[model samples]
Each structure stands twice: as structure tokens, then as C-alpha cells.
Target: MSIIVDDDTRLVVQGLTGSEGRFHGLRNRAYGTNLIAGVTPGKGGQDVEGVPVLNTVAEAVSAHGANTAMIFVPAPFAADAVYEAVDAGIATVICITEGVPAHDMLRIHTYVHNLGVTLIGPNCPGALSPGKANVGIIPAEIFTAGNIGLVSRSGTLTYQIGHELTQMGLGNSTIVGIGGDPVVGSSFVDILAKFQADPETEYIVMVGEIGGDEEEKAAAFIEAELTKPVVAYIAGFTAPPGKTMGHAGAIISGSSGTAAAKKAALEAKGIRVGTTPTETAEIVAGIARG
Candidate 1:
């Protein structure tokens, strides 16, 4: 009942011959994720951990029914890797590579929408649906299956929050890292809408940072329509103005990316806002437990 992936989900690693592809792919398989195949052009005849290697996503998908693609290609070729998965009809694509030029991602974003495919990350820690599947580079030990749904722009922050929530006996239904790129795939509103409709999700935790108008848009949505209890946290409150924080998406241009603004916006919409990582889980658990 997770949004996209599950325990039975079949996965293929694009650029599987590379170090990142080999490493994370092995970790994913070890985590009980179904690692069906890997793709590396000109290395098609090889195998990684008994999983057949194909030169193209089309070949892998045709032969092994791999509907999900975890991409580890370099930034320059990352866009094409995404398109390859989409063309192969991959239902979900998770890109773990970072530093993709914004223009490349914008083009890929448009192409993915035209193809009706889902892209998870470009500079992200990836996502996990707890006991179902682990896509991207998120650590497997920090998650547990329960009632809350988490959406975050920071990978390490998401892990910390999940750990905190787990300590409180508050597990998650689906934990997604929407990435921290300026023009990346997915947003707070996108994941939040999905969680709002998911029956297994009773409460939600949204981890945001200072950047873009996405948080403002999410606040408007929550104020107008969403009924599920939302607990939100914004990072980079102590960051200096005009400086881009750790995340590429964590820029505060003319106060638009201030944590205080995000908190105020969410609070005005009747959502609880946490000032710190520890507080994030505490507030979420409070509303969820109540």
C-alpha cells in the first residue's frame, strides 16, 4: 500500500557497472529490495551479484520485467538515463547522482511528465517505503513501517527525523526525499497530496528548507483543502541571508527562503511547525498520538 514501491517491486540499476551503481545496488539487494537486473552499455553480457546486466534499460525491462530504475550515471549523462528508463516504461526512476545542471533536469522533467513517469531525485538521498523497497541512497536501518508519511528535501535530516520518530514508536508509511535541487522532481505539495489520499497514512511529517515558493503553495493547499494533520519543519533558520545553505534548494533570496517565513506560513494554515529536528518528531508524534 506504499505509494510506488514495495517488497515485491522489481528494480534495475542504470549504469550498474559503475562503483556507485554496484555499491548501492548491493545494499539495496541486501536490504531485501528485489534487485532484478542492472544496465551498463557495452557490459551487457556481465553480471553483478547474479543479476543479469544489460546494455540498455529497454533490454533489461523487456527481459526481467524491471519497472523501477535506480540511476547512478554521471551528471552529464543523467538526463538521458532518466529518459531511457521512461522510454522503457519504468514506473519509477530514482536518480542518486548529484550536480546535474538545472537546464538538463528541466528538460528531463518536461519529458517525464509527457511520458507520465515518476522521477524521485537528482541530488537527493532517495526514498524508502519501509519493508517494501529502498530506492536511492537512504540508509535502511532508520525506517520502520507505521502510520505516518514523511516527505523531506534533506536526506540526512530525513534520516534523523525518522530515527527520532522510531524512538517514539511512531513509524512511517512512506518516506520520500524529494531532493534539494532547484528544478528537481517532486515537491512538498506533490508528496503531501499523495499522503493525504493514502488510507494507511494517518498523520504526515513534511521537512522543508528555505527556498522557492513551494512551501507557500503547500501551506495554501493545506489551508484550503487538506484535512489530514500535518507537522512541518524548516531547516536553515540560522543561515545568513543571500547564502545558499547546504542544499541546492536551500537558498534564501530576499527572505523568500527564510525558515521563519516557512514556519509562519505553515502555522497560519493550522499546521504545526517544529523549530528543530528533535522538535520535528516530537510535534509530529504529539499530533499523531492525540
Candidate 2:
């Protein structure tokens, strides 16, 4: 019962001929994902260790029934790649390329929404449904299949929390790195809704950072909608105001997007907030054990 990806995911790598794309695409395939095809213009009819490489996404979909597209192209061409995937009928698109212009993403986000397609990231680590599918760049080895669902803005922090939970013998249903870009494709509420409805997911871990009102909005959603228990960890507790942190969206404007403010908002909604990744995993462990 994983959201976004599962055993049925037939994926096409958009930049499969490039070094980054080839490396991670094959890695995902090795992790057991059904890598049905690859897309590399001017390199059609080729193969990356046997995965068929086509010139366009439309060819991949029309021939191989590829429903998912993973984009590893450079930032300059990433948005057009997304448009190609969506127009070609790819159900889900995951863009791992970072540094995509915000305006380009702004247009891509609206376009996908209007077309009723799902987009994962422009700077994301991708999603993983342990033992089922690995869509992006999330490390597959640290995960085990279980009922815990995780959604995070920070990719590395998502990995840290996932590693901690695995060490505590807690497995995950799905781990979604929604990317830390300001205008990402998915939001915490969007992923939370999916996790809430997933039958196999029993618990959720939301990792937020200082930025926007995303965490605050997610707190509202959790209180009003979600029935499963959620444990949260907010990064950037010490980030100075008016400055951006590791993520472009991770900036503090006065006190509106401060870590303390976000934590308070969630705690007020009865969601336990953890000060650190390890502590957050410990809290989930206690809840799961109890």
C-alpha cells in the first residue's frame, strides 16, 4: 500500500544516457524497480546495460507502457522534459535535477495540476516504497517494508530519520522526499492526504524545515483530517532570520517561518515534535512500541 510508486511502476529515465542518469537509473533498476525504458535524444535505439533507450518520452510510453518518468537532465532542460513526460501520458514524473529556475517550476506546477498529473521534484531525492519500488535517489538499503509512512522536505534529513527508524526495527510503507524547492510539485498536505488514506500505513513521520507556511498548513491538515499518529521533526531551529539555509525554500522571514513557530503550531495540534532526527525516531519507536 505505497503511494506514488509500487511493484506496478514501469519507469522511463529521461536522461538515461548521461552519467548521473545512467548511474542512478541503473541503481534504481538494481534495487528492483521495473526500469522498462530510457529516453535520450540523438541516442535512440541504444541501451544502458540492456534497458532500451528511446529518443523521446512518447516513444517510451507508446512502446513500453512506461507510466512513470524520472528526469535526471540538467536544470536548463528539466522543465521541458517534464512537459514532454506529461504530454506523453506519463502518470508520474520525478525530477531529481536541482537548480531549476523557480519561474519554470511555477509554470510546470500549474501545468501538471491542470492536467491531473503527479510531479515529485525538481531538487528532490525521490520516493521509495521499500521492497516494492525505488523512484528517485533515496538509498534503498536503509529501508524495510512496514507500516510507517514518511514525508520530508529535506532529502538528507529524510535519510537520517529513515536510518534511525530502521535501526529501531521500524519499517516504512513509503518515504517521499517532496524536495525543498519553494515551488515544489507536492506539498506536505498532499502527501499527508495520501498517507492518511493508504490502508497499510499505520504511522507517519513528517520532517519539515524552517520555511514558508508549509509546516503550519500541514499541522492544520493533520488536526482536521489525518487519523494516524504523526511524529514530526523541524530543521533550521537556529537559522537566522532573513537568510536562506540549505534549501532555497528554507529561509526565515522575521519569525513567520521559524522552527519554533512551526513546532508550536504542530504541538498545538497534538502532534509530537522532535528536536532532532534521532529523537524524532525515538518518539515514533515509543509510540509504535506502546
Candidate 3:
């Protein structure tokens, strides 16, 4: 069984009337996700690709039994959307919007934890269980069901590594994009813990970036808590200091969010850290084979 999503998971689009929302919603339906409903406050009566639209998440959940929500709301209002989804008892929420205000995420994060719900990302691409269900915007073509559990902070890098793994005949149990937002929902450690408990997951691939100390925290967790082999990659080797590095790339106060620091932290705990996305697959395969 996959940790986050599977074929049995039902999906709903929070901003279904919008272009990006509609595009991905349709793709999710086509890719075999159970696209049950859509939510667009003012466009309530409208239909996006035959999926019924409702004004609020509560209505959608009541009408369609949607347990998962994919939010396409703008960054400014993403927090409200997430709050609504969780308040309405949507068990899992995937917010795909980027650039959410830090304060907004902080409040929403508290709400999520309080409600005892699982939140994936406010700026993330989402999580996908290939051949089962997908909630978010990762390239569905690059995935398949297998024993490896993959999680990443970089959207495109996760896709690249997953594609490489597929090409090498190594598939994933679940691939999750924890998002790149600094204060967004979930973390490498969060996914790692879940993967650790998942029986189908034989190993984990954690992709991180320079910025905060989240990777270091995950390294510590790996050293103490996890028994499975963990292969990792942290981007932003040449990224300049003080830049956000595209999604919450872990910002340090005075130091640059450099790749060397993150790699060193993980490697110290016996976790293999890859230098490039291409090498991540090779390292994972090597670990699994060993």
C-alpha cells in the first residue's frame, strides 16, 4: 500500500473553474484518479469537464464523498482553501499554489495539525501513486508502483529522478512533493516517518534543497528512527546567498543554502547523498541491490 495516495483515493479540485485547475483536474481524471467534484465559490453551478462544481469544500465533501482535495487557488488565498478543506473533513489536502505568504501558512499549518489531518503542500506539486491515484501536478507518465518510496522538495527534480528510476526498471511505492515553500505543509522528516511505517516501502529517496535545517533534522531522524536505506539529493549547489531558490529552499540566516552543507549532514548519518538528479536513481538502485 502507498503512504499518501492510491487508486482508491477520490479527488476534488478546489479552483476548478480556473485554467490550471481545469487542466490538471482533467489530466487527473484521464490518468485514472477518481475525480469526483470541483469547488469554485462564485462558479458553483458550473461544470469542469463533467465534474460538478460546488461553492465550498463542505458541499463537495457532502455531495461526493471526496476525501482528498487538490487546491489550485492563488497563493494569497491558498491558506483559506486549505483551512476549508481540512475543516470540511477532507482527510488529505494538496495545495498546488506557490508564493503563499509565510504568515498564512503558519496559521493554516496550526489548523491542520489541530484538526488531525495530513497536509502535503501549499507550494508543492502533490503526491501520486502510479496506477492508482494522483493528487497534485507531478508528471504521471514517469511513475509506476514498486517498492521504493520517494519524496522531494524540488518539483522537477522529483520528476527527473522518478523518471530515471522508471527507466532503470525501478518503480516507486509512492512519490510525494513536499513542496518548496519555507513554511508550507509537510517535510522530508514527515514523509520519511510515513515511509518508515509503510510495509510496501523497502527504501526511501529524500530530495532536499539548501535553505532551512529541515534536511539536518531528517538526517538525525534517519540515524535514530529509520531502518530502511535512505538515498538523498540536495539541490542549490551554486545558488547565490539570500535568494529563495524557487520554493522554500531552506534559507539560513547568514550562510548560503548550499548543497555541500546538506549533503554533508545527511552523509554523516549513513544516508547516501547524490550530487545530481540522474545519480539519485543509480544510488537508490545500488542500495536496494545491496
* Backbone N/Cα/C clashes per model: 1, 0, 7
- Residue 66 in model 3: lDDT: 90
Lowest lDDT 10-residue stretch of candidate 1 = 1-10
CA RMSD, predictions in order: 1.2, 0.8, 1.4
lDDT per residue as tens, model 2, 1-290: 78999999999999999999999999999999999999999999999999999999999999999999999999999999999999999989999999999999999999999988989987999999999999898999988999999999988899999999999999999999999899899999999999999998999999999889989999999999999999999998888999989788899887689999999999999999998799999999999998
TM-score of 2: 0.98
Scanning candidate 2 in windows of ten residues, the lowest lDDT window is: 246-255
What's model 3's lDDT at 279? 83
Tell me the spans in candidate 3 whose CA falls farther than 4 Å from its real position.
248-252
lDDT of 3 by residue, 106-197 (tens): 88888887877889987889998888888888888878889999998878888999999998888999999988877767878888999999
Q: Cα deviation in Å at residue 143, candidate 3?
A: 1.6
* Distance from true location, Cα of 162 in model 2, Å: 0.9
How many backbone clashes can be found in candidate 3? Answer: 7
TM-score of 1: 0.96
Off by over 4 Å in 1: none
Overall lDDT per candidate, in order of appearance: 0.86, 0.94, 0.86
What tens-digit string does per-residue lDDT give for candidate 1 at 54-161? 989998788899989998999989988998899888988988888899999889888887877878888987778888888778887878999899898888899999
